[model samples]
Target: MIRVLEPPRLAAHRREPLLNVPPVITVLAAAMLLIQLVRDWVDVETGIEILALFAFIPARYDPSVLADGVLPGGVAADAWTFITYAFLHGGWAHVGLNLLWMLAFGTPVARRFGVLRFLSFFAFTAAAGAGLHLVTHEGELVPMIGASAAVSGFMAAALRFMFADGGRAWRPGVAEQAVHAPAPPLMDVMRDRRVIGFVVVWFVINLAFGLGEPAGLVDGSIAWQAHMGGFLAGLLAFPLFDPIRRRPGSDSYSRTSRF
Candidate 1:
């Protein structure tokens, strides 16, 4: 089927600064959780306990493996938890804010990097976040969950895309970019300080929230660790997934991140 492009979804053209990928996913991710929250709230007694289910920790699935470490001591639960926790939410507000940030930054980065690249970055960063948590809360059963790792990856990708070479040049059509056309309304506001500032604030808030959440709440959420892991992973891995880039004169910018 020949898929028609949605004007707003395009990310290749330098029309403005549309957040094509990450932000949209962020919005969608949060929306799904929100719906679940409402449903659970309506029937509190039988809706599967919001706090535990929404959090994404593997132990929540069986509770019998709570005492085990992620790999050395427990079942293969850790393998799945590494990725599954990403979808789990904590509260309505928690998911809501995370989605907001994801949309705020993810879309633009996706626009620049394309879909597959974004997904790769998201997955790796998520794993990294879990890895960090595993190190700190290895034995206590923190039940770590959420998109903080992926979201932080977006931030890292954005930094690389925007700052690597004065932020003016961009690679178009690296992946099968469906939405590559220009959307002036969306693009125009992207470069504004307000948006950039918001991203910075997003990081700060995550750091603060990580400090206050209860122990064993989402694997003892060390939000900073997730954020840090994601950011670093994005920076290092962008070249692999960020479609090959070529300089204006050097024939092509190496898609590989040698710099």
Candidate 2:
């Protein structure tokens, strides 16, 4: 009897879910959305009051303003507004744009940094943004609100490792590995042509926003300074937050290794 040879069946293809966002990202997004909803539900006066209480107003630190007690929340507001302002936004448009960028850049960061590190990084960047805003717009009464600065920071942090190890090309099913891959030293990253190009483009866009807003070419004033501060902080402080330790005499850092 002759037995016929048959081809082996192929394994079923596993599909990745469309929305593979980390839980921390989801929770942060929800919190911002909920805050915006409450702000919208309140009356105009209450909404303004909310901004006064939570938004980062440069004038809050002004000696005269502090003495007058014009702003609510007092000393507590002085302390909390650095991060609380990130949760507030001008409107749905502002918050929606922020959420979009946050998801795009924050996913990889959250995945790599884990929960606590990511949260601390977020607060650090937000505070840095607020600090810079105060410096640039000192004693200004305008309240700065939005998550753009922190989102910008996430974008900067992601850049540290996104292009490492031939990751410049996008390949399906390997995104997880790409983000978790070891990052090059900051000096090497600065020298990389790809990284340099992205930085130039990002700064150009911010410059355009800064110029256009004053010319009435843009609708709302963009807090580009705050964005710059957060981005710079993230780019420089990445090593501190990175769990991956670099092997001595090696160009790359690894998560499995010890310092």
Candidate 3:
């Protein structure tokens, strides 16, 4: 009997684990939802009270409020509001939009930065955004609430690494190809047409919303200043948190772990 050799079988293409996203993103979104539920179903007055305590309110630092002394149940300077306010939101739509943006952009940043760094990035960017809001509208009495600042930060960070080629940069194949393409320099990023275009569009949208909100053209309040602050913080500060990793092989970008 003659022995016959058989051809080796090719490995089946494993589906990319797109659904296996980072857990932190889900947790952050859940926290927002839980807070919103409490605000809606719990006591409306009590919820507002809680929001006043935790939400970022520049008036908290008013000279009169300071001279009157920080009252227990009244507005007072609370340093924690910077990070705490991000967990609170105005309404379902506000929270929903922020959560969606976070899930989209935060996942990649969290995957790249890990749990600890991601949390730190979120907190710092949020604080920075609040600071900007304070500087811009020091006399405003309204409380600034929502995760837009942190989400904006994540957006800017995503822009740094996500847009490898252009608007078509994030394609699965393109991601893999990025392993070979050197990460664009900070300056080069500004020069890239895609980046420039995205920045311009984002700036224009925020400006329109910011200006229109006061004119009563846009519904609800939009903390456009906070968004800009967060975006700038994430864009300028990403390098500090990012780990210095050598460019991976051409195929490495395709591997979900690179995310």
**Steric overlap count per candidate:** 21, 0, 0
Model 2 accuracy (lDDT, Cα) = 0.79
- Alpha carbon RMSD to native, model 2: 11.3
- Write down the lDDT of every candidate, Cα atoms only: 0.54, 0.79, 0.72
1 against 3, candidate with superior TM-score: 3
Model 2 off-target regions past 4 Å? 1-18, 65-68, 166-170, 214-219, 250-259
Give the better candidate number (2 or 3) by lDDT.
2
TM-score of 3: 0.81
Rank candidates, lDDT, best first.
Answer: 2, 3, 1
- Highest-lDDT candidate: 2
- lDDT by residue (tens digit), candidate 1, 12-114: 3444444344554755585558665675566755433433343334343334555434333244444655665676665555566567768765776666555
Q: Highest TM-score: which candidate?
A: 2
In candidate 2, what are the lDDT values of residues 1-259, reduced to their tens digit?
0000012221111124235788999999999999989988999899888888998889889986556587898888899999999998777777888899998889888888888889989999998988998899898888888888898899899888886654462344455666667778788777778888999999899878765664322235888889988999999998888877768887566674322
Question: Per-residue CA lDDT of candidate 3, range 153-204, in tens?
Answer: 9989878777866645476434423323345557868877889998999999
All candidates in order of TM-score, best leading: 2, 3, 1
